[model samples]
Target: MTYCVGMKLDKGLVLMSDTRTNSGVDNISVFRKMFTWQVPGERIITLMTAGNLATTQAVISQLEERTKEPDERDNILLKTPTMFQVATEIGNLMRNIIGERQEANGVKGRGRFTASIIVAGQIKGMEPRLFMVYPEGNFIEASLDTPFFQIGETKYGRPIIIRGYDKQMSLEDGVKLLMVSFDSTLKANLSVGLPIDVQVIGRDEYEASHEHRISHDDSYFSAISAGWGDALKNAFHSLPDYSFYRGDD
Candidate 1:
């Protein structure tokens, strides 16, 4: 299990994914869930995956290979003229991989090889876009009203995003929001342990403007965790008392 979140903002895009995988409590391991592709000033793309590690890695490896091969093969990086097309290609690949695994496992297959991804990027002339691709090869885009998406162990952290997100928030504030979201998920779910990989792509810059591996010892993330918790508690206590309840008492 893992947690991956992507936000579409007025200024640009922000993405984060954890590096935890587990077969059981004793079989836990760390594997990065984020991947990126860039053509410097022309385009930049980032992917965060969740679900079966093997399937996700295979999908990423296949995309990377297409960009390197002289012979053109249909791939997210090559055949897609736009970010929308790139997402379609990725979705199709995910569905194909899932079907192949199910067939190989025969009657005992639990459909366990499924995976999902969040895709976001900017092309030379277009606005930055964000998408959540599901295991079924279909996806939904993030809009102004619904400005963010998450996969895997998402429920624990979703509330913070819902309450705090704004389309105009700066990249700095966006990163802070994601850090709080991850902190909440980490505290509540053992399956979503951390060492988070984060990347920020600013609009029209066509390269990753900021990227980092945030471990437990990272000072800024530690501060974010502590600060958000204290802020929430103070906010709760500062709220006015219920007058109806007071009269009843």
Candidate 2:
């Protein structure tokens, strides 16, 4: 399991993903869930994946292969004129890969070989965009009404984002918001462990503006985790006491 988030802000985009994967309690491993492609000043794309590792890896592999032989293939990531087209190509590729696996296995019901992705980035002449791609190859983009997307082990961390996300927040605040969400998730679920990968893309930069890998011992994350817990407890205590209760009865 993993926890990945992509935020579309007025300033640019912020993305984060945890690196833990496990088959069982006794069998655990770490594999990066974030991938990026760039053409220097022309374009930059970042993909954060969740669900079946094999399927996600295969999808990324095929995309990379296309980039290597752009002349022989459509290579939508490189050749597409707009971010929307790039998303369409990725969705098509993802659907095809899952279909092939299903046929090979001859299975019907939703099985283990399914995956989802969060695609975020910007092109030279376009605004930064963010998308959440489902296992069925369909996707939804982030807008003013929905400025962010989360995938994999999402429930544990969702409230923090819903309460704190601001369209005008700076990139620094965006990263901090994500950290709180991730910290909440890490505390509640065993499947989503860290060292988290984070990237910030500034509007019009067409390249990564900042990237970070936060480990278990990171002081800033530690402070945020502890501070949130304390704040929650303090808020709970400060709330007005119930008036209907009879304490001595």
Candidate 3:
């Protein structure tokens, strides 16, 4: 399992994903869930994945290879003229991978090669966009009504985003919000471990304005975790007490 989030803000986009993958309590491993392709000032595309490690890695590797080979055919990195097309190509790749794996392994259910991805980025002449690609190769884009998308072990981290998200928030604040969301997930779920990868792309820049890996020993993350916990507890105590009996009387 893993936890990844992509937020679309007026300033740009913020993405974060955990590196942990676990088959069971005793079979935990680290694998980066975030991948990016950047053409410096021309384009910057990012993807965060969840589900089968093999399938996700295979899809990403093929996308990278397609970019290097030249655009004789319509590949994700080369054929997509816009972010939407890129997402469509990725969805198709994911669907194909799932289909191939199912045929080869003869799995009993629809989960063997099941995976989802959150794609976000900008092109030279376009605005930043975000999409969530399902295992079926279908996708939905982020918009005014839905400015964020999450994949993986997402439930534990979702409320924080819902409560704090704002379209006009700065990229820096967005990063902080994601860290808090990740911290919440880490505390509640054993499958989602640390060493988070984060990328922040500024609007129209077509490149990452900030990118970093937050390992277990990162000082800022440590502070955020500790401080957020204390702050939450303090606020809980500060809230006015409910007196149902008095209100009823």
lDDT per residue as tens, model 1, 76-154: 5843689999899899988888888888887243488888999999999999999999888999999988899999999
Q: For model 2, state the Cα shift of residue 81 in Å.
A: 1.7
Tens-place lDDT digits, model 2, residues 1-249: 889999999999999999999998788999999999898899999999998898999888888775566666643477678888777778888888888898899967576788898999899988898998888888999999999999999999999899999999999999999999999999999999989999999999999999999998999999999999998999899997777767766
**Judged by lDDT relative to the true structure, which candidate is superior, 1 or 2?**
2
lDDT of each candidate versus the true structure: 0.89, 0.90, 0.91
* Cα TM-score per model: 0.92, 0.92, 0.93
- For candidate 1, the per-residue lDDT at 139 reads 95
RMSD of each: 2.6, 2.8, 2.4
Please give the TM-score that candidate 1 achieves against the real structure.
Answer: 0.92
Native-to-model Cα distance after best TM-score fit, residue 139 in candidate 2, in Å: 1.1
| Residue 240 accuracy (lDDT) in model 1 | 80
**Model 3: lDDT of residue 107:** 73
The runs of at least 3 residues in candidate 1 whose Cα sits more than 4 Å from the true structure, single-residue gaps closed, are: 66-79, 107-110, 242-249
